[model samples]
Target: MRWITSISYKNGDGEVALAFAPEIAQFLVQLKKHFTSYQLSKAAALRSTYSWRLFENLERFRETGIWEVDMDRFHTIMETPKSYRRNFNDARRFVIDPALAELAAKTNITAQVEPIRRGRKIDRLRFTFENASQMKLAL
Candidate 1:
């Protein structure tokens, strides 16, 4: 469950590469904990996405219960680089893993992400980027 990322120097927007696995949730937790600073890449944007181009760890969702099911409007915004994460941290706070966030700054490993939209049965998929787009770094 390794992913590559595309970081944007412009407004800090970027893309992602998706790789699904049984440990997807745990893997994403690691990413949230380690993909900060300059470790981010661009390939990650295209890995496994449709609307929500960003990555989400299922384990984190279960542990923290910070899941968002209907974020179509947000994903719509990220589809354009011009309207990426307005307040970088603000955008990721709810979607990403919290423990990883606590450690992100320590290692400078955080990927400013873009949120994707969702499909009809997206609820069934544990790890899905099928409804997201990439854009922005911060507000």
Candidate 2:
């Protein structure tokens, strides 16, 4: 049988000892950002899940000795995704929600959002409000 192991190296344990297959390493890189070397090393030990398969024949991994299977395949099996959720609370902290509330106090008309675009060099992210006669931007 093969089982993927993610050994923790905390409180001064070689910092980072794992050497995964190239794909597995890349997958980890994508998930982590703005982390220091110490943080990255700790994050590497986190595993979403493990994958295992029992070998029918005895010679599946090695001739006779014990085997250490890389957890790449197991990571791959659990990595299939369904949907992405935007963190609305955190997003509100940064932008937009307060601005909408401010607009509500100013206008007697109802407002619907058109799409919000990312700001460029001079152009700002804009929100549009539509009443009966015309549409105006609330930027």
Task: Give all TM-scores, in the order shown.
Answer: 0.18, 0.19
Residue 55 of model 1: what lDDT?
A: 29
Model 2 per-residue lDDT tens digits across residues 1-139: 2132454565765575455666577667776753223223222322222111111111122233223322233123323222211332333333334434433333222333233333522211222333223324458
The best candidate by lDDT is 1
Cα distance off (Å), candidate 2, residue 88: 7.5
Clashing pairs in 2: none
Looking at model 1, report the run of 10 residues with the lowest lDDT sum: 123-132
Local distance difference test, per candidate? Answer: 0.36, 0.31
Cα deviation of 47 in candidate 2 (Å)? 46
Give the Å shift of residue 18 in candidate 1.
Answer: 36
Q: Candidate 2: how many backbone clashes?
A: 0
Per-residue lDDT for 1-139 in model 1, tens only? 3443333343445644454554565666677665323223432332223222332332234333344543444445335232323433443444344423332322222433333435532221123222123433535
The per-residue C-alpha lDDT of model 2 at residue 62 equals 24
